[model samples]
Target chain A: MIMKKTLKFAFQKSLPVLFGYLFLGSAFGIMLQQEGYNFVWALFCSIFIYAGSGQFLLVSLLSGGATLYVTALMTLLINSRHIFYGLSFLDKFKKMRQMYPYMIFSLTDETYSVLCSCSAIGGIDENKALFFIALFDHLYWIAGSVLGSLMGQYLPFDFAGIEFSMTALFVVIFVEQWKSFKSHIPAVVGLVSATVFLLLLGANNFILPSLIVTVTVLMLCKNKVMEKVGGET
Target chain B: MAIDYKTAIAIIAVAAVCTFATRLFPFALFSKSETIPKSVQYLGKVLPPAVIATLVIYCLKDVNLSQFPSGIAELISIALVVGVHAWKKNTLLSIGLGTACYMILIRTVFA
Candidate 1:
């Protein structure tokens, strides 16, 4: 009965991620299928790599015949934000015993969002709830990828600009973060740096440079940025 | 278009390893220690807003402004997203409508 209740709670909390992942995960799978891989490959990538945006980029990287070293470096840079997520969870996760590994492995943006607010839910074992949330979210992603790849293989319709959903999702998050924060310096720095780098380096070679410059500039002005935001709040 | 089995496996393995490394870095470094450097904490707090903004621009990297349609499809769709989201503050609505708008524009109007 307790397990049933916990599972119910987990599903309710994961509803938002369920929608987002199914859409984005299937998009990744469809894009992979367009590049000539099958559902098996989609399943493998989703299960192993498990990062949605990184997996999307992986399709292009693989299609381009990028070297192993290049793939490693690019994936690391693209998913670098996960490192920060781990930092904030260190203490909470340590007490979760065996659940720590899976929790760490499944700390995607959506999962983190869900977990951050998880403390508010009363009358449940929080650690078990977290584990179930992580597990369900992972399964949802795998299911979406497999389904999308299968559909892409057999189904016939124009999906030409469907990829724009990824862009739209990012835009929504940017808007949300903009509204949440008092200081806009970091956002401005990111936007300006990326825009300038995109112009100078073109689409193919701008991410690394843009990221480097953004981080450098943010670090240099950390005190001022923090002071401004701190003053506001 | 299929990558060779060996190379494909290698790439997948490398990617999995790299991703796990990032997720595990802080835990491995600070597992026995309680202190997180001040600079690191500051970056943790501030980097997310900026990184997300960077990604938003990164997604638009391929848009061409000098062409005939220019970036009209992208611009129109994004404006709709922003407007809808600002009004409703609904995540799914903004993305679904913006994406649908983009798909329609590209297929019919832009084409």
Candidate 2:
């Protein structure tokens, strides 16, 4: 009974992801197919890689015939932001026991955002919900890629700007988080740091530096920030 | 396109391993201790909002403000999302409407 309830709640929480992943994943699939690979390659990459941006970059690397060393380096640089995500989930996931490793492995940007905002409701198992959320997202990605690779050229509709759903999802989460917290300092720090770096270094090279600056600023003012958050919660 | 099968597989494997390595790095460093450091705990608490904000900016990084559309489509759509979400507090409705607004803007007004 608890398992069923958990699955239902997880499904509800993952609805936004279902749309975002399906669209982005299918876009990845169509791109891969146009590069001469087929659905099998799409399935393999989605299952193994699972990083939305990283996988898109992978398709390009494959076509460009990038060396293994360059592929490794590029993947690390592109996905380096993930290092910060695990910091927030360390203790929460540690309690998940058997699900710990998988939880860590599946912590994509979307999953991280959802999990960060997902609060525990009464009578529901948190760990199971987390596990299912991860599983559902992974499945949606796989299904979308396979579907797109098989029918990409035949799709009648134009998905030109459907990718904005991802941006909108982020906006929704940001608003939710904003309302939940008493302090907006962290959000401001993140905004200022990212915008500065994005202008300084182009889009392709801003994430890492921005993250470093944000972390450093937060660490430096930890006492003040904690006072506000700690008093509220 | 000119790459061989063996090379392609190697590239995929390397990318997968490297991606996993980034996700695993934080855990490997901090999980060994029975008690996480106070500083690390502090970051764990405050980083989520900051990170989410950064991600929002990251998603919009490619929109060129100097161009013809000049990010008007993104600006208008995001304003609508924030306004409607603040008013309705409905997640699905906000995202659905926001995306639809962007799609229509790009295809019709900005096309």
Candidate 3:
């Protein structure tokens, strides 16, 4: 009975991840295939990079013959924010000694969201579940990459418009968070900060600056917001 | 027949090692302190909205906005998503439905 409930809860938690992995991963696969990297390359990149932005950026960088150091530097720049994310859960996860490495490796923006929100004691069992969820996503990306790479060689239809899925996913998350939260501080802070940084930094450099601004603003929003907001999550 | 086995193997092994090192470095390098520093916890609280916002704008950075219809469609979908999320407080339905609407607008009406 307890196992059944855990399964149900885990399913509910990971459903969004499932949707994201399949559609976005499939689309990314098509792109990789069109670029002439075979299925194995796709699988390897998806599993290792495991980051949507970094992987997408890596494809073009590799195609352009960028050096390994250059690619790694760019990847680090894009994903540095994850360092802050990893910090939050270290205390919660230190108990699972054997599982800690895989647990940390699988930490994506999506996985972090799910795991951070979970109220479970966050022991080895929860760590296992989170790892599996990430593994499931990793598999979807590999499968989609293979399908796209093989199919692209023969398929004629345009794969032009699929990148919108990422935006579509973002829109929904923004909306949901906005609606649920009582105070508009977080949403407003995000929108305003992004717009401002987009103006100041242009497209490429805006993220880090905007993140800094958002963090500065939110840190001052009162601690009770997180604790007493009931379902403001 | 077309597979470049050497390049493929190189990419896999190198990327795997590098990736593993990235994930493993923090756990191994850091002292075994269970109690997180206050600064990290503060970041944890501040980062959710900040990250969400970053992901959203990043995706739409190159959106073709010179044309009014696609532009309108984009804004409309964002608005619809916002509306549904605010009213129902449902993440899945809001995102799924909003994406469905976007796909339709782009493929059928805009096409």
Best candidate according to lDDT: 2
lDDT of 2: 0.92
Docking class of 2: high
lDDT of each: 0.80, 0.92, 0.64
Expressed as tens digits, the lDDT of each residue in A1-233 for candidate 1 is 77777888888767656756775788888898898888999999999889977898899888988899899999998887676677557777888999998888888866765565355366677778888989899998998898898886564676667667667766777788788787899889989998999899997778778877987898888778878778321
Which residue pairs collide, candidate 1?
none
Clashing pairs in 2: none
**Model 1: CAPRI class:** medium
Q: Give lDDT tens digits, candidate 3, residues A135-154.
A: 66566666666666666546
How close to the true structure is residue B27 of candidate 3, measured as C-alpha lDDT? 57
Question: How does chain B of model 2 score on TM-score?
Answer: 0.96
Model 3 residue pairs with clashes: none
**Model number with the top DockQ:** 2
| Full candidate order by lDDT, most accurate first | 2, 1, 3
Query: Sort by TM-score, best first: what order?
Result: 2, 3, 1
TM-score, cand. 1: 0.78
How far does residue B86 in candidate 3 sit from its true spot (Å)?
3.2
Write model 2 residue lDDT over A1-233, tens digit each, in one string. Answer: 88889999999989998988998899899999998889999999999889999999999999999998899999999999999999998899999999998888899999999899899887789999999999899999999898889999798998889889889989999998899986799999999999999999999999999999999999888878988889422
* Total colliding residue pairs, candidate 2: 0
TM-score of each: 0.78, 0.98, 0.79
Q: Identify the superior model by TM-score, candidate 2 or candidate 3.
A: 2
Model 2 agreement with the true structure over B56-77: per-residue lDDT tens digits: 9999999997789988999899
